[model samples]
Target: MRKEQRVKKNKEFQEIFKKGTSFANRQFVLYSLKQEEAQPFRIGISVSKKIGNAVCRNRIKRYIRQAFLELREDVQDNHDYLIIARKPAADMDFHEVKSSITHVLKRGKVLKKTSYGKNDRKK
Candidate 1:
């Protein structure tokens, strides 16, 4: 993810927390705030000490970033997103993290609906 696409400031995170709408699953909480201007989406991630040590928290953060990278095209482009990882996330691998984030995005109605071709079908 590019620096421009990340929400790094404490102020920004607080604004999103206060004004954004949130969606959550068992493993993660997602906060989304739509921007008035046209720009690429930005994301902020928070992993608490309660989840694990630095290594474990970093791993979960990495997984979440990678998941967002892959889902970038499908996600709305003019919003700021904040993801907070729960305890169950520490034990999950990359794929689990991706699917869980996808689930949250879907519930939040932030992911675009893509029409799949016949050959594009899974299986």
Candidate 2:
């Protein structure tokens, strides 16, 4: 993701938490707000060092980015989303991370239930 597409700072995160909405599951929290972007939606990923070392955090971030990349079409367009990795996410595998993040997105109404179907079109 580019600099303008990502939510990188603590203040940006907090603002999203404030004005945006959120849904929490066992493995992650999805925070989102509407953006005026013209193209497809963009996402930001955040994983704290408190979870583990740089390696662990990067692993979690990679899994999440991959999950989102795979489901980009099913997600609503033009929304700014933040996927915050929770502690439980560290113990999960790739599919678990995908499921957990998908669950949160579903709960947030950013993604429809049928979005999980394997036959769904790619973005």
Candidate 3:
């Protein structure tokens, strides 16, 4: 991910928290806000001390980042997203984390609909 495509400023994170809509599952919470100035989506990852120590937190963050990277093209651009990890998230492997992120994003209606089965596609 590029620096330009990350939410790095504290003020930016706060603004997203204050103004954005959020979705959550057992693993993570996703906060999102529209920003026309954002060419591609900007993302921020948060892991609280309650979840674990530094190593554990960093591991969860890495998993979340990898999941987002895989789904970046399917996600809507021009938005800022904040992903806050939950306690259960610390125990999950990469595939679980990816699916959890995908589930949340789908619930949030931020991802383009993908037809995985031939019968599911129209036309």
Local accuracy of candidate 1 as per-residue lDDT tens digits, 3-116: 999999999999999999999999999999999999999999999999999999999999999999988888999999999999999999998898888888889999887712
**lDDT-based ranking, best first?**
1, 3, 2
TM-score of 2: 0.83
Per residue, candidate 3 scores C-alpha lDDT tens digits across 12-84 of: 9999999999999999999999997748898999999999999999999889888788778788999999999
Q: In model 2, where do residues sit more than 4 Å from their true spots?
A: 1-5, 9-11, 112-116, 119-123
Error of 3 at 48 (Å): 0.2
Off by over 4 Å in 1: 115-123
lDDT of 2 at 94: 93
Model 1 lDDT-worst window of ten: 114-123
* Candidate 1 deviation (Cα RMSD): 2.4
Error of 2 at 2 (Å): 5.7
Tally clashes: model 1.
0
Worst 10 residues of 2 by lDDT: 114-123
What lDDT score is found at residue 107 in candidate 3? 82
Candidate RMSDs in order:
2.4, 3.1, 3.7
Best by lDDT: 1
Regarding TM-score, does 1 or 2 come out ahead?
1
